[model samples]
Target: MHKSQEKIPFWRVKKLNQMNSEEWESLCDGCGKCCLEKLEDLNTEKISYTNIGCELLDVDKCRCKNYAKRDHYVPDCVRLSSANISSLKWMPSTCAYKLLSEGKNLPNWHPLVSGNTDSVHEAGMSIRGRAIAADDAGDYEDHIVQWPK
Candidate 1:
């Protein structure tokens, strides 16, 4: 008979500061939805997600075009700091960070769980092959959409 397996202590179980670099990196599902440009209603402070992406985002890859110096190119680029994870309001509802912050379990499609990098894409959660470069998208209004809708 196989012996009982030891449980893996996930980052969600630990506080942000408790996570090491590798654990912190694994938190990302890499859907690239967060990289998309968003509009906030200044009066109500409500945010609307758009299909339009940041100029530095790679449409298919859903990663920063210049990750090393992202802040240099995009002055407002948010560095995913453990210190700010709890307060970052714009993170997607499906994001692992948000899910964990709210004490929810990670979804089955998450790469960390499925051990498949393309699972997000296979689940239709990714921006792959669907995004148009920001520089090429003329009007922000034109890019407005709720993907599942």
Candidate 2:
């Protein structure tokens, strides 16, 4: 079959745990919502997103400055492997990983669907230009936002 006529690939067909590393990594839409610091209500157990991104996250680009060494730089950073995907309740509604975990299809703005890395930013789904670096954050509670939650 021609390259254009080839199948759409298995993101829509395969389960999250069944995907290979490259396929799994490609699922990230670069929304940067996961890079933000989150707050949880001790009483209600509700998770709230913050506009304060991690120190290493490039707020303008919506990407980590040191992705390969992110865990080394920030020990507390939660690694989103297949094993932990189902347990993360704080992921944004637009997150590809979370959507797939919930058995939902990816959105049209996703890079995998749009075939453009900038689609997430263009669709206004990314944290670009909307978040502050954690280094500049004053108080976690003050930075709480409802958009990505």
Query: How well is each residue in 1-149 modelled by candidate 1, as lDDT tens digits?
Result: 33546565676468767888888888898999888988777999977777888999998888888978988999998888767877988787888877787778889999999999999999988888777788888888777767611
**How much does candidate 1 score in TM-score?**
0.87
The best candidate in terms of lDDT: 2
Total backbone collisions for each predicted model: 0, 0
For candidate 2, lDDT tens digit of each residue in 5-30? 88876897788889998999899999
For model 2, state the Cα shift of residue 7 in Å: 0.7
Candidate 2 has its poorest 10 consecutive residues by lDDT at: 4-13
In Å, residue 59's CA in model 1 sits off its true spot by 0.4
Clashing pairs for predicted structure model 1, backbone only:
none
Q: How close to the true structure is residue 106 of candidate 2, measured as C-alpha lDDT?
A: 93
